[model samples]
Structure formats: C-alpha cells, structure tokens
Target: MILVSYFARYREQLNLGGEKLPLDASLNTVDDIRQRLIARGGVWADIFSESNLMCAVNQDLCRLDQAVEDFDEIAFFPPVTGG
Candidate 1:
C-alpha cells in the first residue's frame, strides 16, 4: 500500500487530507501514481489539473517523475505559501 496525502488548499478543495491505495497493481514512479489518480476522475483529476503540483515521498520533497516504492508516504500539494 502507498499513502497519498494532500496539503493546504488542495486538501480542502478535495475534502481530503490523505488516503492509502493498494499496491497490488504495481507502480513504478510518482508520476505513474499521479497520472493514475488524476485519471480516476472527479476531485483528483480536477486537483491535478496539470503536472504542476508539488510532491513529497517519505517526507522528502521530490519531482513529479521520481521513483516510488511500496508503503511510501507520498504527499501532493500546490506550491506552499508563507507570511
């Protein structure tokens, strides 16, 4: 299984903070998951909008196309903001 999380506005817009997906289907990279999720349609598809969101795998920021593995905690969010 893999944990997919959303932060900030993305989270609120999707009415979710995170979820875990079964890994039985096999996935290779972050981009693959992103594509699959977006393809699921509805909230995820709308949120992804494009390949322009930020991603973090296991608490470490990474590119959209980075490699991914089982049980990895992956986070997706729009670029952050600060005061």
Candidate 2:
C-alpha cells in the first residue's frame, strides 16, 4: 500500500486530508501518483498542477521522477514560503 497526503490549501480544496492506494505496476514514481490524483478532475487537476506542486517521499524532498515503492508515504503541497 502507498499513503498519499495533501497539505495546506490542497487539503481543503481537495476536500480530503489523505488516502491510501494499493501499490501496483501502474504506479511507480512520484509523478505517477500525482497524475493519478489529477485524474480525479475538478479542483484536483488545478491543485496538482505539476508547475505548482512539490512532492516528498517518505519525508524527504524529491523530484517528480523519484522512484517510489510499496508502503511509502507521499506528500503533495505547494512550494514553501517563509520570511
């Protein structure tokens, strides 16, 4: 199983905090998981736009092409902003 989490505005906009998906051949990278989320359409497509999103695998920042495996935790959020 894979754990997917949406943060900040993404959580509110998607009307979900997190979800779990079974790991399979169709899902292999961080981007693959993101594409699946966007397939949900509506706000999901907008919120998960590749240009505006940041992804993390197992708490470590990573690129969309990063490899993923079963039981990994994937987090998606907008780029961080701070003073």
Pick out the ten consecutive residues of candidate 1 with the lowest summed lDDT.
22-31
lDDT of 1 by residue, 1-83 (tens): 99999898888988888999877555788888888888989987888866569999999999977888788999988887789
lDDT of 2 by residue, 1-83 (tens): 99999888888887898999999998999999888888989888888875968989999999999999999999998888999
Best by lDDT: 2
lDDT of each: 0.85, 0.90
* Candidate 1: residue pairs that collide: none
Alpha-carbon RMSD, candidate 1: 1.6
Q: Which candidate is the best by TM-score?
A: 2
Task: Give the per-residue Cα lDDT of candidate 1 at 4.
Answer: 91
The reply for model 1, stretches above 4 Å from the true place, is none
